[model samples]
Target: MKKIEAFVRHESFDAIRARLADMGLPSMSISEVKGSGRQGGYTESYRGAKTTIFMRPKLKLEMVVNDADVERAVDVILELAHTGEPGDGKIFIIPVEDTVRVRTGERGEIVLASHPDDA
Candidate 1:
């Protein structure tokens, strides 16, 4: 199993989610996050004054899937979230040792099956 974590622009969330659904890859957790990458951050202008916005708002999407689905899921996110500019965001894949479904006492692959695509 694998866990795919993607940090994407907040504005691209809707489109990315829709694309994932179309590809039969639903079931994800989304969270609002703030951080800076290689660009370090940017500046904002308000009332003719400039302020340093050190941390930018981003959307974090997390999903656990079978090993076979990792590549496709990563591709879908990358394709849909790209903006051809800095701060477009990044994707990380981590190995998942185990998973459990609390309500039904299911484990491993069985837990993943509860997700839309796995079902």
Candidate 2:
């Protein structure tokens, strides 16, 4: 299995989620996160003053998929998340050693197949 972690712009989450749902891979963990990247954070003005937000708000999405589906999931994220600009975010793919379902004590790829509605 592979774990795909993508940090994307806050505004792009809805579209990304919708596309994933359309592909029968809607199961994921999402969180509102803040961090700086290669371009760093930009400056903003308020009350005639300018300030730098070192950490900008972003949406972090994490999904675990079968080894063969890793590229498919990554492609979905890249297609929706790219804005042709900086701070667009990053994606990390990692190996998942195993999985255990708390309720049934299921393990391995079988654990993922338990959800018929998801891929």
Candidate 3:
């Protein structure tokens, strides 16, 4: 099993989510996050003054799936979230020892099968 974590631009959330669903990769956790990358943050002007914004808002998506689905999931996220620009975000894949379905007590591959990773 594997856990996939992706931090993407806030504005791309809807498109990414829709693409994930279309690929049959459902059951994900989404969170609003703030961070900066190579581009760092930018400066904004207000009331004839400029202020530096160090942290940019982003959307973080996390999910656990079978190891075999890792590549496909990553591809889907990259394709949908990429804007060919800096601060586009990144994806991380980690090993997942096991998983359980709280409602049915399903475990491991059984739970994974319920959430098909068909990207």
Candidate 4:
């Protein structure tokens, strides 16, 4: 199993979610996050003062998929999340040791594939 963590522009969340769902990988966790990449954020002017904002809002999306699905999952994220501009964000794939479904106490990749409807 592998965990796919994507930090993307907030506006891209819905489209990405819909696309991933269509791919049968609907299970995911999302969080509002703020960070900067090579662009390093920007500056704004208020009255006669200028403020440099180093942190920008983004959506952190995380999902676990079977090892075989890792490339496909990453492809969906890359295709939907790219904007050809800075602050478009990044994707990280990490190793998942195991997964357990809380209610049934079932474990491993099987747990990830089980949806509530499967109960």
Candidate 5:
């Protein structure tokens, strides 16, 4: 299994989720995060004064998918999140050694594939 973590713009999050749902990839973890990458942070006007924000607001999306689906998932994120500008965000792919369902105690892919509607 592979874990896909994507840090995307706040405004694009809703569209990203909707598109993922359409692709049967609704299960995910999302959080409001703040960070900076290559372009670094930016300056904004605060009460008519220039203020630098080192960490900007972003949406962190995380989900696990089969190896075969990695490319598709990445593509979805890229297509939706791309803004042709800085702070567009980044995606990270990591290896997931294992997973266990708390209630059923099922392991690995079995746990991942068991959606609530099927239970």
Candidate 6:
């Protein structure tokens, strides 16, 4: 199994979510995150005062998928998240040792299967 973590622009969330859903990959954890990368920070003016903001708001999406599905999931994210600009965000793929279902005590790749209750 593999865990895919993608940090994307806040405005791109909806479209990315929709496309992932269309690809039968609707299950994921989304979190509001603040981060800084090569783009660094930008300056903004308010009331004639210039302020430098170091942390930019982004959406972090996390999904665990079967080993065979890693590329498919990553492609979906890349297709929707690309902007050809800095701060377009990043995607990290990590090996998942195992998964467990709390209720049924299920483990391993079998836990990746969709459960009716998960809907």
Model 5's C-alpha root-mean-square deviation from the true structure amounts to 1.9
lDDT of 2 by residue, 8-109 (tens): 998889998998778767779999988888775578999989998798888999999888778888998998899999888999998999988898888998
Supply candidate 3's per-residue lDDT for 114. 52
Model 1, 27-51: lDDT tens digits are 7899999988987547889999999
Badly placed stretches (over 4 Å) of model 5 are: 45-49, 114-119
Best by TM-score: 4
Residue 105, model 5: lDDT of 84
**True lDDT of residue 36, candidate 1:** 88
TM-score per model over all chains = 0.87, 0.88, 0.85, 0.93, 0.88, 0.89
Q: What TM-score does model 6 achieve against the real structure?
A: 0.89
In model 3, where is the ten-residue run with the lowest total lDDT? 110-119
**lDDT of predicted model 5:** 0.88
Question: How do the residues 60-81 of candidate 4 rate in per-residue lDDT, one tens digit apiece?
Answer: 9999999988999898889888
Each candidate's clash count: 0, 0, 0, 0, 0, 0
Which stretches of candidate 3 lie above 4 Å from their native place? 115-119
lDDT, model 4? 0.88
Residue 31's lDDT in candidate 1 = 95
Q: Over 4 Å off in model 6, which ranges?
A: 116-119
The sequence of per-residue lDDT tens digits that candidate 6 reaches over residues 30-116 is 999898887757899999999999998889999999887889889888988999998899999999999998988999988886667
**TM-score for model 4?**
0.93
In order, candidate lDDTs are: 0.86, 0.86, 0.84, 0.88, 0.88, 0.88
Worst 10 residues of 5 by lDDT: 110-119
